[model samples]
Target chain A: MEVTTHSAADETQVWGGGNKPLNASYGKMMMWFFIVSDALTFSAFLVSYGFSRFKFIDSWPIADQVFTHFPFLHGVDAPMYYVALMTFILIFSSVTMVLAVDAGHHMQKAKVTFYMLLTIIGGAIFVGSQAWEWSNFIRGEYGAVETKGGQILQFVDAQTGKRASIRDFATSIASERTTHQSSNGIWYQDEKALTTVTLAEVKAGFEANPNLVIRTQQLNENDQKIDLSRAASLEKIEEAQLVVEGANLIRNEYGNRLFADFFFFITGFHGFHVFSGVVINVIIFFNVILGTYERRGHYEMVEKVGLYWHFVDLVWVFVFTFFYLV
Target chain B: MAADAHKLEIFRGLLKFKSNVQKIWGVLIFLSIVTTFEVALGIIRPEFLLQDFLSMKLLNWIFILLTIVKAYYIAWDFMHIRDERSGLKNAIVLPLIILIPYLAFILILEADYIFEVMRNGIVSWNF
Candidate 1:
């Protein structure tokens, strides 16, 4: 037979000086440590975002203009509303998660189950909203001419703050390029055909519609927008291809490319965390339902998983503030 | 026995919030208000404030401040760090606090250098 002896110091060391009567376990402590480390990792990402913003201080894309798209509102200007809703959903989930944890403390199994289900629903909704945002971003809105200099000059209305596209003002050209989709041409299956509407066609269209005005890449000395006053000058510049409306990197009809990049990197990362968190929570949830901890006469497993769920919620709070709110 | 009584009193005090639901909701509502304020300032950016602040724009500063406030609440309340032991809390948080700012400062300084190079370098690289 094995014999063991324990002292008061050992009891205190194992149980946190008896101050915490909640009877948390080693797994819970480790989870807290993991959360802190993960939080630091997220902080690094957000801080890098800030660094980049400072780098492009003068020409950074406006967040409102970039993230203005809302579901079922085709071409309607709605800014920050969708993201705000996502934030609310995540926060609501966090609340449900805490309620579940509180119920766990009291060993109310049914209440824990209900709150956990609510949390899962919230996570699903948030992930779906993110997917919608991604699809809209990838499917760009207005096409523009890419410059050899790699600089983008977007079309803007002088009278209104709305964006304009080539299709809005220009008609398609009769002339077509010689390149075909067959083996002879520069091709990799030719997934999509290039735009048939040439600059010449646009010029003709502009001439036909005198109400339309053209804005170019070049700015005057005062850093203000300049438009072509003379039809002849416009025609000449159109022929040379020197005054084509440039592509928009910031506040385009689709959205800002930087916004897409940040969204994918930051929120995608957070989403991955949430996904893993759900997987872990599901495992523990099943265990709780099966009464594994009940067999052992303790529910510490629930507390451990609860800590992790709360950590995931905490990270979302910061992401909401920096990405959506700020 | 006396020590046990003291620890119980401390535990009771920690759990003295009206309810877990109420506490969580209170934090969420506060966070929402702060976010709304940030968005409002961003949209209705007043002219006088922008003109006054030279080094850092008032709008940008406000965003940064609000962000910090949000971070603090998230860490303290949501993560339950406020209820943790002082030693454990410092062991985790203090290092992160020092290191994050240090890393941010270095990265910002480098970014500024790159900006200067782009602005004044002999070979023109237009943004």
Candidate 2:
């Protein structure tokens, strides 16, 4: 390949006196610029996450409670372990990618191929782990009862912080069904069906089950959990609301609605990036194995991809810290 | 010529950082320690520390500080930013540093306003 430098005045000048201190190639410079722009995009998402979190500061569902599921080990209240593992996988992949780039520098084709393969495996594992997390999130564990005031009242065992499900609290109310699917007399299927259990049904059930108690929206002065007083005024206030069944974007079994939204948006966005990154990596991997770079007498393409892989890993670090840790 | 060859060997040794194997292991160990610290802070949530800080909880502040440290190491060592020129590093990072915080501050302030409206307003706005 020919290396040429145009005069500083030239629009497409590859090198200039101002750029003398840093002797990086045009491609590397562009990659840095791309990374900066991408970082900003991620920052915007994270900042929005922070904003939402602050908006629902008092009632935001605790991260540990929301993401409590561990794969295979059902009912285990493992928090952040899966995400930590995912972080390790991505970071390890980044290490392998860097190693591959280093091997490329030394013209060690076999070593480069080996490290690259390992990197690909790591990426696949991280992506799989992410999918598992999404499944767990989408299929919520302990369902809650949403009030008319848009507050979720989740049942928790007073002794254990583990969430108490509706199954534990309320028996399913049996309702008679019509023979054919009709619109006028029966509720239309096309239109969204109202919740099966009204607040009245739930209240009656609660009254029947004296053991079952209410968890309120307001936190105590000390920010500790406050059990609802069986005051007549409170009972009247609670009776006026609705009882939502399933978890939607706006609401979840966990008291906080924003929790589900953030989980979906952040993880979904990151997952999409990982999917695209894998596709790009696959293309580059195939090209590497095919000796494209060897023919070109430069392995800078591998380095460029490695940069992207590292950036993905970098983003995960922040996500893990913000979403899982604090 | 002999001196030049010796110098080249020394340069290679420096690049290798005694052993690339040892360095990789060291980085992994360091990362684990940082993560452990973060988890420990979260689990423990020391009362004294909580009482001392306003808005900035000790656990949260620790997580943020550790996160910044991790980001620095990842950028400088893993991404080879430390090997790059100061000018290149500043050019890439400074804009993001400036814009991101500014955007966060404005958005968070707006979210605060929304929160106040939701809390105090007579009329209801669906969250």
Candidate 3:
């Protein structure tokens, strides 16, 4: 509340023209400033994710169950393995990027070029792995029924205590169901693509199966979905309104549509960053090969970009924890 | 032109590296170990970690803490913030320290309140 005016000498001492206050170049300082702001943006996204998770705290889909598919290990419950591998890939790329920067410091042109190539390769693989993960998520492994109240009722083999795919039990019921286009229905409206199985068929299959029990989205004390008894399962099936096969912006076989939305938004955003980082790395790698930095007598560009690459890796560390581990 | 202007010590000088390249690899190995441990704990979901503490599972707390540790090394070592002057380090880190937790507290607390209202209020959310 008290205003104290400093002398002009004090002002000049602080401003002190021709001095780098933080002892960093203008470009590097700006990169750090950009990173700081970007970090805040990412934190906002993650904290909102936390908000949504807390809101649906009781019914949030278990990360273990949702992300169980591993590449080439189909039908096996290998949760977190693929994501863990992705994490390692991204981190390894960060290492190479930093090493490239270190080599740049020593004026080792060939070493910088070699490490840059490795970093680029690692980044490409990481992006590829992410694309595969997105595909698997979009094409969900097991299908579930969506109740009229938007609750997800997943099928489980009670005897085995494992997930049961709707395809395993859904009987083929011939029905005159056609996709409604603008020409067929109202000119202004069209139906979305239909799931492989219809609700009626799912209901009929449930009636025919004695071993299948319905697991509600709600979690019990053990942090697992609550599976209904046989009679309760039969009763719960009556409330089913639609068959959900995979994830999209609207809904998912996974419980809580918000979960899928956040997953797509957050990871998709991070993946875009990785994509751009790879592009940036490729450009820098080319410059390194062209001896541009060598002729310039410094490799500050590589160091600046290395900061960006390492920041990307840092974000993934948090994303991995919040999205998968926590 | 000594790039060794960058410090060689990490873990508060408990460990020191001979070269920047070796330090990069050291941090990489450390991060990998943290990630592997996180994945293992996630898969196991040990009985003790399931207990609720401070409105969250102990396992979740561990995950968040380890994640912060990983983030620290990535920023401080890999990004060369440890080599930066203290002014820049504070400029980069202090705001995050003050603001992220503040935002998290407010938003998460409100979310929990909404959850309570949805569970106990006149409107039935679960059918």
Off by over 4 Å in 3: A1-16, A183-187
lDDT by residue (tens digit), candidate 3, B1-127? 2587878888888989998888888888888898888999998889988999998999999999999999999999989988888999999999999999999999999999999989889997776
Name model 2 segments beyond 4 Å from true. Answer: A1-21, A158-162, A177-204, A221-225, A230-246, B1-16, B19-22, B52-54, B120-127
Which model is ahead, 1 or 2, in terms of lDDT? 2
lDDT of 1 by residue, A1-326 (tens): 88888898887787765465433346766787787788789889988877776665444555565577899998987777888778778777776776776676667788877887888788788878887876766454444443334333444454664556666766766664753665765656553344445656655665665544544444453223445544643443343332233122332332223544666788889888878777777776777788776677666676667667767766776676667555
Q: List the residue pairs that clash in candidate 3.
A: none
Cα lDDT tens digits, model 3, A227-310, are: 999999998899888899889998999999999999999999999999999999999999999999999999999999999999
Error of 3 at A264 (Å): 0.4
Clashing pairs in 1: none
**Of the candidates shown, which would achieve the greatest TM-score relative to the real structure?**
3
Which run of 10 residues does model 1 chain B get worst, by summed lDDT?
B1-10
Across A213-318, the per-residue lDDT of candidate 2 in tens digits comes to 5565455644455565445324643544555555568666666677778777887788787777778788888888899988888788887888888888888888
> Which stretches of candidate 1 lie above 4 Å from their native place?
A1-24, A174-259, A296-298, A324-326, B1-16, B48-54
Return the lDDT, model 3, position B92.
95
The A-chain TM-scores of all the candidates are 0.73, 0.83, 0.94
DockQ of 1: 0.38
Better of 2 and 3 by DockQ: 3
Candidate with better TM-score, 2 vs 3: 3
